[model samples]
Target: MDLVRIGDKVISRHKIDSFLTEILQLRSMGLSQTDVAARLGIDRTLVSRLENMGELRKGKSVAVIGFPIANRDEIYALMQAEGVDYVMLMSESERWDFVRQKSGIELFNAIMELIALAHSYDQVVVIGSGKRIKIIRAALDKEVVGLEIGESPIQEDKYVDPAELVAVIRAIKGGNV
Candidate 1:
């Protein structure tokens, strides 16, 4: 057990951790704040404040897909940091290699699988040429956030602004857009 000393008062870190775990478990089990507080003999506001402090995003799963991106590594790191559930990013050459490596039937099956997986998420963010984004949006049934990096027939990798993508992600997570 870890101990913390504040002047003459001593606190057990283990006890505090266990208490917090119980509170969160109760909340996850669908207990109301008031009910949890009454059972734990704590204030209702404490439960509310604890939940607010730990909340990262609204309970929605998000997926991000981008291709022929110049800054794929930067965007991939950003997506991981932001807790994006699914990420598919590729450079121009990588995209071509991917297509060239697969047979026609294999490619079709793979695309169908990707679309099926994407349908499981609450929202999808597609970063590509305008036409590709439109096509993806039309295929998906759920919310689709499009970040058009270039016009149709984009042959070269285009750089996407990290700040712009972050804003879109935050808006979606905050239920603002």
Candidate 2:
């Protein structure tokens, strides 16, 4: 990598590339075009053009992942009505059985698969406790809308309001939540 010197300052192509990559990543993570441009000392139009140029997937797709849901049927039905693309809902026993059924490698692969599937969607709706919600958000590292049912070490299913979840999903899908 050759560093170009201008007066007392040095400019690097690698550094520029890294900066652009960071800006693009931030945009992908849901930053506004104007914010990204301001952060990087670039034009907002350029940011918009860059995003349009890089878009590989179009439209908003949503994925819902939850466990130990008390109103599973109601929530699932509402999600179905909302036209959710991917839905993964499990009870406590079902979650235990799922984990116990998989070996180490299988579990790892399954987790990766889930992550990959979640990444494909524009938004991921996670329904779980606070701790698990944070973990999912960090793992997905995208636009995650968490539905906190309760705290960790959960012993009972949390009752969810279907209408409330639908409204939240609607807001998220509309890019307001």
Candidate 3:
């Protein structure tokens, strides 16, 4: 345990941290603020204030997935800047390598896992060929925004305009897209 001496009193940082963790865990487990406060012997307003301090935004979660992208780095940076919940971007060579390195079952399991994760997001932005976008839209049940970089069977990496991607992200976060 670590102690901090302030003036003539000693404070237990560990105790404070444990209380914070417990409070958040209880809140996440569907406990109301009043219930959590009563259980923890804290003011209900403190719980509300703590939640507000940690809140990032007040909108739906978003995911961005793209492959065979020449500007993957640029797009990834934009996703990070916009605080996207999930991001998956790959170049043509990287995508080919990823498929070739995995066994048949492993590849299938990986694809299934990706689809399951995408299902958790409120919206998904798919950037690829028209055919690929159509396939993803068919697989996912949530709202999907398709930004077609090229026609079907895209064999080469296509450059995605960074400004266009930023606009899409802004619109989604603003709940207008």
Candidate 4:
């Protein structure tokens, strides 16, 4: 009985660590708090607490985004005590299948939703970004009024400066969005 209990505890810690890392990475990728919350069917406060464990957790109305966690019940209680959201367990195959068939526009909107939900100070930069992830670049082009940094093969003539890209995002927040 002792050995089995020890094994379970070890597995739980390993799962939680992986869950935390995945969540942070997804947030960096541009998913929003609200999206994450919606995905988990919980409030944004829970998400924030889950992300920031050591510091005093501050709740904001911003939409949050990140990975869907596994072992959610355990994470939830941990969040209550530690001030973070817990994991929502999904099998690896399930996660893969969801992304495999998701449309580009759907992916882009998903990313933007996450970005919008993030802290104002956080800048979610998609590096070497391309349209392959989804039809997001084109959709973003239409919906987003700011400067886009990446080069698009489809739009052979259109180009945007990297510095201007930051300015554009700032401007969008200022009123352009």
Candidate 5:
């Protein structure tokens, strides 16, 4: 077996490569920059820098809009960890109640504000059912990556796969899609 000694310890280059692969996997799994840093005994800023390095464009801005997601909070956390500039994530019950309980100008203003906010981003990743995706795309009138997850008004919160979403984002960001 061959080993290289950089200082006091000897290690295989394969081991270093393997460790790097794990770190990237953990990152893909939606672990926060801080959590990855803690796990790797590295600075959190370094993790942030590594993520920024993969960003397709600087200052182009990305946003996420999803609803009725069962794992809304976790998905939101993942978006933040991935460096999305804006997010409007809500569970099914929360979104329904928001509209159902409001009336007159109250509802109108809220709806308008949300739409206005959604239009601010350069690219928006819309996660919803086939039906909702159509509506969202019509309203936003911007670059959208519509990720359909069946149909909605669903009773259960949809559990989104972080890795799948990450792949779509990477493709969009890298201009591959």
Candidate 6:
């Protein structure tokens, strides 16, 4: 008698199953396979195979990547709604490394470029948190060209209200603020 044991499997098919379900859910909800790949940071071929397997659920727009971590679309959408056109997402370590390699001037220039991209918008919103937020706030205060840093010099006093930031950008560009 020959018996097949699931435990004999080399790879974790469950993970594959999970990935498939997630991809299918995203696809049915109107996300293309390429979009799924971009959000998941994986190849489109993997998503294609999973869709073919029929291991996916019918309709689920959002896939929870290991609980707290979600794909990029949610983050991007949230930023957009918040009126933030200049969104910089980097790790704390990366922020520190950037500051170390480039003088505040160079970093300031790069940030201005990001803000300038929002010319079509009425205002530019910069979304950040933690050390990243602090660094961005500081760069803005230095008159980063496109941004209107708050009147307060103190970091605590410097807050980024999406609406306020937009107002300031409009004023500056329109020569009102």
Q: In lDDT terms, which candidate is top?
A: 1
By lDDT: ranked, best first: 1, 3, 2, 5, 6, 4
Q: Which stretches of candidate 3 lie over 4 Å from their true place?
A: 1-59
Give the winner by lDDT: 1 or 5: 1
Task: List the pairs of residues colliding in candidate 1.
Answer: none
lDDT of 6 at 31: 94
Location of the lowest summed lDDT over 10 successive residues in candidate 3: 51-60
- Per-residue lDDT of candidate 5, residues 1-177 (tens digit): 657987898989888678767777897777988898999999989877765655544237788888778788888888888778898888878988888998979999998888889888777888889788888878877546777766765566787888888877766666544
User: Each prediction's Cα lDDT score?
Assistant: 0.89, 0.82, 0.88, 0.40, 0.78, 0.47
- Stretches > 4 Å off in candidate 4: 1-70, 80-91, 120-177
By how many angstroms RMSD does model 1 differ from the true structure?
Answer: 15.4
Q: What is the lDDT of residue 42 in candidate 1?
A: 100
**Per-residue lDDT for 1-177 in model 2, tens only?**
569999999999898789778987887688888899888889999887766665434337888999888888788888999988888988787888889999999999999998988888887889889899888888978657788888997767778878778987776766545
Alpha carbon deviation, residue 66, candidate 2 (Å) = 0.9
- State residue 52's C-alpha deviation in candidate 6, in Å: 54
Colliding pairs, model 6: none
lDDT of 1 at 132: 92
Candidate 4 lDDT, 1-177, residue by residue in tens: 112246446345666667666665666567897786776566788778875653322232111111222333343343344322322222334446566767988877865764444323222222222542134335333222222324443322223243443443343334322
Model 6 ranges with Cα > 4 A deviation: 1-74, 77-86, 118-120, 128-177
Clashes of 5: 3
State, as a TM-score between 0 and 1, how close model 5 is to the true structure.
0.62
TM-score order of candidates, top first:
1, 3, 2, 5, 4, 6
Residue 41 displacement in candidate 2 (angstroms): 28
lDDT of 3 by residue, 1-177 (tens): 599999999999999889889998898688999999999899999999987765535347889999889989988998998999999999999999989999999999999999999988887899999899889988986457889999979899999999999888887787544
Least accurate stretch of 10 residues (summed lDDT) in model 2? 50-59
**Candidate 5 segments exceeding 4 Å error:** 1-59
